[model samples]
Target: MPAAGSGLYVGLMSGTSLDGIDAVLVDFSSGTPRLAASHHVPFADPVRAEALALCAPGADEIDRAARLSNALAQLYAEAVAATLARAGVPAAEVEAIGCHGQTVRHRPDAGYSVQLVNAALLAELAGVRVVADFRSRDLAAGGQGAPLVPAFHAAVFRDAREHRVVVNLGGIANVTDLPPLGTVRGFDTGPANILLDAWAARHLGEPFDRAGRWAASGSADEPLLCEMLADPYFAARPPKSTGRERFDLAWLERHGVATRRPQDVQATLAELTARTVAEAIARECPGAAAVCVCGGGARNDDLMARLARLAAPVKVTSTAALGVDPEWVEAMAFAWLARQALLGRPGNLPEATGARGPRVLGAIYPA
Candidate 1:
C-alpha cells in the first residue's frame, strides 16, 4: 500500500558510490515516516567520470566542480519529478526536498567535508523548497559531519526491546549501535565496497562485483586481509570517519593489491569489508542483540554471508526486515533531516557524530 499523508516530502541522495541519484517521496504527516514512492536517476558516463576525476588532482577543477554541481541538480530534479509521478502526488503537496549531493571528498579532521550540489538550482528546477548541505554545521560544532544517519536509524529502527546495531555499507562502511538505554554511538568501520568496486572496475570492466560472485570465485589472501585489518583507521576510536580521501585506488595500489590475482584481491576486499564491520560492532557495541544492515552492501551475498559468519550468535538482517528497504534508508535519512530542519530540531547525534551537542543540520533553499 502507498504511504498516505496530508503533506509530503522528497529525499534526494547521490552517495559516495557515485552510482546515481535516489529520490524518495515520503509521507511524514503520520507521526512516523513512511515511503510513498521512489525513483533512481543514473548519472551519464561523462558526468560520473568528471565527478570521480574531481576526487583527486585535475585541471580546471573549480570550473569543473561548478558545472558538475549544476548537472547533479538537474538529475536530482528529474528524480523528484519521477518520484512524484510514481506516487500520483503533485509538487504543491510536498513541503520540501532534502538532498545529500554526491560526496567528492571527505576530510573531517581538517574540519571540512564537501558533498557537491546546487540546492538553489534544485529548488528552481523542482519548484520546491530544498534543504541540503547537511553536514557543515556539525563540522563547525566539532563533529565528523558524517555518518549522520545514525540519529535517523535510532528513531526508526531501534527496538525498545533489545539492542540493535545498524550497519550501512556504502562506499565506506559505518555502524550505529543503539543500546537499550543510552545515547547512540556510530562511526565508520572501514573500507567497504569502495575498494571492491574499484578493483572490479579496473580488472573486470564492471561497475561492481555483482552479488560478490567474482569474489566468491577466489579465496581471500589472508596475509593481505591481516595487514589491512591492522591499519590504524580500523582501530581508530569512535567519533571518527573516513572516505575516498583515505581509501581510494591509490591507497589500494600502495598496499600491494595490484600484484595479486584480481579474483583473490576481490575476495580479500570482501573479507576486509566484513571483518572491519564486524570488529567495529564488537568493539563499540559489545553484546549487541542483532545487526541490521542497510546500503548497497546489503545486496552482496558473498559479503553478507561473511558478515553473518563473523557475527555469529548475533542475528543479522537487512533494514528491509525492519520496515525500510536497504537501498533507500540513507536517502530517507536526508528526507527526515529536511523535516528536522523545517521544525528546528537537531539532526546530528552528538555521540554518533562526535559533536559537542545536538545540532540542527542543513541549509534551506527557498523555492
Candidate 2:
C-alpha cells in the first residue's frame, strides 16, 4: 500500500460565483498540506453566461447542461495537466484528484444538491484517478450536504488549546467555528459575492466590482439594508445552506433592488454581505480567538474592511496569516477530501452538515 500523507493530489473548484477554475497541486507527503503548484483558468465570457443561464429556467437547458458538463470536464483536464506540469510531476506520479464542480443548483432541503462535472470524462482525459460527487452520500444520510470544508478546516486550522473560526467568503459565505471543546459547527451565512457580482455586472459591465470600489464610493442605503436583513434566511437556525436558487436575481428583483438608485443598491449589497457574515460570527462564535477569511471575497478590500469593523475586537484576518492564501482554501479542502476518500476515511463533519454520522464522501474513478 502507498504510504499515507506520502502522495500528491490535485484539487479543482469552480464555486457558485461562476468566476473561474482554481486548480492546485497539493503535496501531502510532508505530513502537512503544501501548495506545490497552482493555476487559475477563467471561464470564457460565453461559458460564464451559459453557466449563469443554467441557474434559472432557460432555453435548451438539458442539452446545454450536458454539453457544459463535457466542456467543463475538458477544461478540468487541461487544468490538471497544467498544474502537474508546473509542479514537474507526471500524471502517473500523482495520486487522485478531488473536484468540486460548479454548483448551479443546491437544494438540500429537497434531498439533492447538484455539482455538475463528469468524473469519468475527467479521468479519461487526465489519465488519473478522480473523486467527485462528494455531497450525495451525506444528502442521502439526511444532511445539509454543504459547508463540507469544516472537517478539513478543523484538520488544518484547529488549535488544540485555542478556539478559531474559518470563514469562506465564496458566492455564499459560510463559517466554521472551531472551539476548544465539543463538536465543530458551520453553516451558510447567506449571500456574499454573488449579489455583489450580479449588481456590479448590471451597472458596471464588469464581472465583479474590483475591490468593491464602486460600493465603497457610495453609502449603503439603510432602509434597504434593513429590509434585506429581514430576510428569513438570515434568522433561520443552523444546519442550513443556500445558493443561486435562494438569492439570485429573481430574489433581488422581488426585493425591489431595481427601483433603488444603482450605486446605492450596490453599496447596500456589499453592506448586506458584510453584515450577514459579521453578525453570524458574532452570534455563532462569540469567543472565537480570530476569524480568518478565505475566498474571492477576501480579496475585496472594502468587504474585508466592513467585516473587520463589524466583527471588531474579536479579530478578523485572512487565512494568509495561518499559512494559507485566502483564495485557495476551498480547493485545498477538496484535495484533502480526495485524500480521505482514497484512504477510506470519513470527510464530512456530522455537526457541521447535520449528517447522520461521519461518512466517507465522494465517488472514486480509477485511472
Candidate 3:
C-alpha cells in the first residue's frame, strides 16, 4: 500500500460562485503541506451563464447537466496540466486529483446534493487518479455531507493555546470553530458572495464589486438589512449546509430588494454577510481569540472592514497571515481530502457534519 501523505496531489474546486476553476499542486511529504503551484481558469461567459441557469430547475435539465459536466471535466483536466507545469512536475509523479465538482444544487435537507463532474473522464484526461463525489458518502452515513473542510481545518489551522475560527467566504460562508479543547464543529453561516455576485452582475455588469467598492460608495439600508437577517437559514443550527438554490437573486426580489437603490442594496447585502458571520461566531464559537478568513471574500476590503467591526474583540485576518493563500485554501483542502480517501482514512468530522460517525469520503477513479 502507498504511504499516506507522501506524494504530490492536485486539488480542483469550482465553488458555487461560478467564478472559475482553481487548481493547486500541493506537496504532502512533510507535516505542513507546501503549496507547490496554483492556477485559476475563469469560466467562459457561456459556461458561466449555463451554470447559473442550471442552479435552478429548468427544461431538459438532465441533458444540459450531462453536457456541462463533460465540458467541466475537460476544464478540470486542463487546470491540472497548467498547475503541474507551473510546479515543474509530471502527471506520473502525482498520486491523484481531488475535485470538488461545481455545485449546482445542494439540498441536504432532502438528503441529496448535486456536484457536477465526470471523474472518470477527468482521471483519463489528467492521467491521474480522481477522487470526487465527496459528499454523497457522508450523506449516506446520515450526515449533512458538507462543511467537509473542518477536518482539514482542524489538521492545519487549529491552535492549542487559543480558540480560533476559520471561515471560508466562498459563494456561501461556512465557519469552523476550533476550540483549544473539544469537538470541532462547523456549519453554513449564510450568504457570502452568492447574492453579492449576482447583484453585481445584474446591476453593475461586472462579475463582482471589486473590493466591495460599489457597496462602500453607498450606505446599508437598516430595515433591509434586518429583514435579510430574518432568513430562517440564519437561525438554523449546525450540521447544516446551503447553496445558491436557497439564496439566489429570486431571494433578494422576494425580500423587497427591488425598491432599494442598487448600491444601498449592495451595502445591505454586504452587511448581511458580515453580521451573520460575526453573530455565528459569537453564538457558536464564543471566546474565539482569532478568525482567519480564506476565500475570495477576504480580498473585499469593505466586507473585511465590516467583519472586523462586527467581530470585534476577536482579531480578524486572512489565512495568508497563517501561510495559505486565501484564494487557494479550498482547492488545497480537497487535495487533503483526496489523500484521506486514498488512505481509507475518515474525512468527515462527526461533530462538523452531524454524521453518525466519521466516514471516508469520495469515489476513486484510477488513472
Candidate 4:
C-alpha cells in the first residue's frame, strides 16, 4: 500500500437497512479529497434475508455468522474491484480499502459493535490493504462507538461563517452538529429508512417507498405518531446510537401498528423520522443556519417535505449543494477514515462518540 496522504482509497459501506454495498474510490492526492469513481452492488435476496436474520439471535448462530462473514467479504471484494475498474485505478496504487462491513448487531452499551467482514480475506481478494472494524476501539474507550461520520463531516462540511448540521438518513438517522466554533457533536436521531423500507416491502411489494409516495398518499396517525415519539431512544441524551435491535418490524407491532391502516402507518413512520430529526436539530443544534441531508432518506420527497416544514427558518437541502452527492457521502467518509488510519491519526471525534479521548480506529490487513 502507498503512504496515506496522497493516493486512491476505496470505501465500502452496507448499513443497517440491509441495503447493498456502496463503494467509492476517493483521490486524496490534492489537498482536498475528490471522488474518482463510485459503484453499488445490490444484495441478492437470500443474502439480505440471512443478514436480517442474523441481526437477532437465532439457532446455529455461530456457524451461520461465520459463513455469512466469508460471503460478505467476497461481496466486498467484488465491490472494490468494480469501483477500481470504474475509476481506472490500479489496485497497487490504492493505499487501502476501508470496509465498514455488515453490522449484524451494534450493542455499544455492552462494549461491542459487530461488523462482519473477513478483513484478511478482503485484502487478499482485492489485492490491497484493508481497514475494517472501525468501531471496536471507540467502544473500548467507553464511547458509544457510532456516529463516527461526524469527524468526517466536520472535516469536509464545516464552514467558519455558518453553523451547519449534517444529517445522514440511512437505516437509522444521525445528526452531526458543526458549529461555526465549538466541539462537534453527533448521535442517532432515530429510525430512518429501515422501518419505512420494511413496511413498504410488506405492503407495497417493493424494496422501498420510492419518494415516500405511499406515505404521501396517507395521513399520519397523530396518536400513533405521538406514542412512537415517546420511545426513550428519541428522548435520550446524546453520545448514543441504536439499530434494528431497537427499531424493527417487531417494534412497530408492539405499538399496535397493525391496527392502523398500512398507508397510515407508513405515513406515521415517515412523520416519526421527520419529527425526531427536526426535534434533535432543534434541541442539540440550536442556531444552526442550514441542515445538509445525505443518504437514502434524502431521496424521499415525502420525508424531505415534512422535515422542511418542521425545520422552517432553517434551510433544508441535500449535501449536493455542498458539493457531495448525498448517496455517496458515507462511503466517501469511510475512504477518508482509511486514510486517517493509514496515517496513524485519530478518526473518532471524542465529543461525538464520548470516548475517553481521540482514538485511531480500525485494524489493517495487509495486501
TM-score of each: 0.97, 0.97, 0.98, 0.99
Give lDDT tens digits, candidate 3, residues 249-343.
98999999888899999999999999999999999998899999999999999999999999998999999988889999999999999999988
At residue 234, give the lDDT of candidate 1.
88
Which residue pairs show collisions in model 3?
none
Which residue pairs collide in model 2, if any?
Answer: none
How many residue pairs clash in all the candidates, one count each? 0, 0, 0, 0
Candidate 4 lDDT over residue span 1-367, tens digit each: 5655547889999999888999999998887779999999999999999999999989999899989999999999999989888878788889999999999999997899999888999998999999999999999999988988999999899999889999999999999999998789999998999999999999989999999999999999999999899899999898889999999999999899878899999999999999999999999898999999999999999999999999998999999999999999999999999989988999999888999999999999999
Per-candidate Cα lDDT values, in order, are: 0.89, 0.90, 0.92, 0.93
Q: Which residue pairs in candidate 1 have backbone atoms (N, alpha carbon, C) closer than 3 angstroms, thus clashing?
A: none
Assess candidate 3 and give its TM-score to the true structure: 0.98
RMSD to true structure for each model, in Å = 2.4, 1.5, 1.3, 0.9
Ranking the candidates on lDDT from highest down gives: 4, 3, 2, 1
Model 2: residue 116 alpha-carbon error in angstroms: 1.0
Residues 204-239, model 1: lDDT tens digits: 998899999999999999998888777799887998
What count of clashes does model 3 give?
0
